[model samples]
Target chain A: MRGRARDGDEQRFLDITGEIGPELLRYFQRRIGSDAPDLVAEVMVTVWRKRALLPLEHEHARMWCFGIARNLLRNYSRGEQRRSELSRALRATVSVTDVELDSEEAVAIRDLIYQLGPDLAEVVTLTHWEGFSLAEIARLQGVPAATVRGRYRRARLALLAALSTDVAPTLL
Target chain B: MTQDKDHPAGTDRELGALLARGARPTTEATTEVRDQLAEMAAAIVSTNQARSRRRAGLISVIVAPILVLGVAGTAYAVTNIDWSQLWHNTPEWAEWAQDPDATVHYALPGGGTCELRLGEVVYSPDPNRPADVAADPRAEQAARDFLRTADLLTVADVDAMITAMRDKDENWAQADDGTAVPFGYGTDNYNADVEYNMAVKQAIQVAVTDHVESMGIPSTGLGFQSQEQCTGADQ
Candidate 1:
């Protein structure tokens, strides 16, 4: 019986990882840049430890994993002074500018998104980049859907204004 | 990049497209990440399986009989007594025991196991003290000291510590006598249990102080009760 339960847990973990692994990798890559793999491993370990609490529903499980990842990211940021040697090596080998952003426009847009502050930037990223609904983002973030919606709206306006300014100089 | 067909309404279509393009993963990178994920998942599964095996062995030896005794005790009480009297006679401490703040199980160095049931502001050590401790005074003091200083943050932490100890020695808590003690109490006998609990708690503190020169955690500060504290009037 215990073996069966263990098997079920392993299968569920693999299933979730298969579905959301790429997205999570991208998330960390975009946010923390080069240390994505180490953080991904940490998040996977947390997911395994808390596997019993994961919701049965697929979308809810995704959100729950993201919630864990968000907390892990917060802890990582807090104790960032103790970054691993591997992360530093990886950062040295691969520049975020070279690997992540394909074009100058995309790089500029990313910079603009970061300028909106972390909270608003996260809302914008989840909505546009990840294609999560405002309600789903709220669930993942432990916030109201209205709040996410408002932040996304504000982020869009900010991005549009920044883009317009960049284009204005060219037009003149 | 292909637009997300189910993109939410009111989002700027151009911005979403641009962000999606930026976020898109290369096939090679995605493959590498998936491989790494598979390896990590395997490691996690292996660790969990090892822990589960150790827990299963420990539970079969120690916990199974206690559970059976517990169930039998409840069953016998229910069948033998008038339901109303049983309900009426149940002390408030019984309810507190039902939802203890912490339950710690430890082994006696010589032989046998015991459980320390801690309430929010009280504690009850299982009546069945380890046989090894019963025979030797110094060993009993050492057991008491261990229990007093056992700092547990969560129930999971308690389980981990128990598992770790069990792994070191399978018969760490094996009792010489294989008899199970039934845990039940009527209203008249409830005070005796509370008194015994307080006495054991006090013994633990005294034992802890006598043994250690300088205590690190100050004997858990469990806010254990005195005889006066355990009363029907207080409840």
Candidate 2:
């Protein structure tokens, strides 16, 4: 597997890099914006060379890569420069998972949603919205299947309750 | 309550549909990003391949000089170099033979080697050490020292020193005393050969060390080969 990655062939580079590149760029776009195009480009280069390190399936690898990207972008956004850009090309591409809210009242339920802690937010993003299976989301977030269920239930209930109360009306 | 062929709970029916709708990717967006990805992927492959080719080409070109010098070195041994014939017939031949930087080709019994070298020693007249080798003990000593230090890079100690010289994070091209020390001494053919060898040795050592380290292991006992070899200027 590692040998193929080192082979410097054009087809192999594209086969792995071609599909995930867009999902990753959008992943970055929703998280940061603007200068993210360049950062995403840099990460893709790293991914091309390191793709052999990935698991067999594309979607799993895509989620795994986004996990790594989240870490890197967080590091990049910390200080050196304020990453601010609504550049047309990047703004044109948004991760609907990040932008779409359930209901207007659902949006204001951040207090309740976050009440389960950041872990709840992660589970929702990975499982409910990102469409990853319960097992995949639990594995990704490094939590057990049961805990993932408990949090998913609590989060949904919080959202529903917030909605009933006419909360911020945005938290899905 | 909820029920469907896919979901046992009806409550999740709305959630699943909404999540699917929310993250729906536009085909047009994926297409545009795919084109950009292909271009960048091609650029990376081109850059890496170009670098590998350049390195191989340089080593081949630089090694070509050794072939020429190896032949000339053998010819000088068997055939007499008549000064008169050399002066009139092949004037350029005299200059080349006399030039310290001439390409010297050597023929061993079965195998051959070559090297391109700088012109002969243009001596400075230090009154105490005249241009004539018989008069200049310092010049003679300098030549001797140059030969002594130019041992096989196979020497464990010498290889270690060369590694140290290269390991220094210095711009060897500059005069900075940062890490790599330049081997500077004289203008004799032997000195010229040794100095060039030192530089080549440093680069080779550095390359080997770097390549090895990149593989997550420390390197040991990997000796570098010199680009130059001795020819029969003695006889």
TM-score of each: 0.48, 0.42
Q: Compose the digit string of candidate 2's lDDT tens values, residues B141-224.
A: 222222223211211123333333444522212122333222233212112333333443343333323322222222222221
Give a tens-digit lDDT track for model 2, residues A90-136: 33443332344344333333345455567766566555444556566
User: Candidate 1 residues B1-235, lDDT tens each?
Assistant: 1233224534466776656545534323445446656655665567556545644554323221111111122322312332222122333445555665445544433233335554434222223533321122233333333333333221122222233333342111111243333222332223223223323443443323222211112112123311112222211
lDDT values for all models: 0.48, 0.41
Candidate 2 — which residues are off by over 4 angstroms? Answer: A8-10, A33-36, A56-60, A73-116, A170-172, B1-30, B47-235
Question: Which run of 10 residues does model 2 chain A get worst, by summed lDDT?
Answer: A78-87
Model 1 quality (TM-score): 0.48
**Top TM-score hit:** 1
Chain B TM-score for candidate 2 = 0.21
CAPRI category for model 2 = incorrect
RMSD of each: 14.5, 22.3
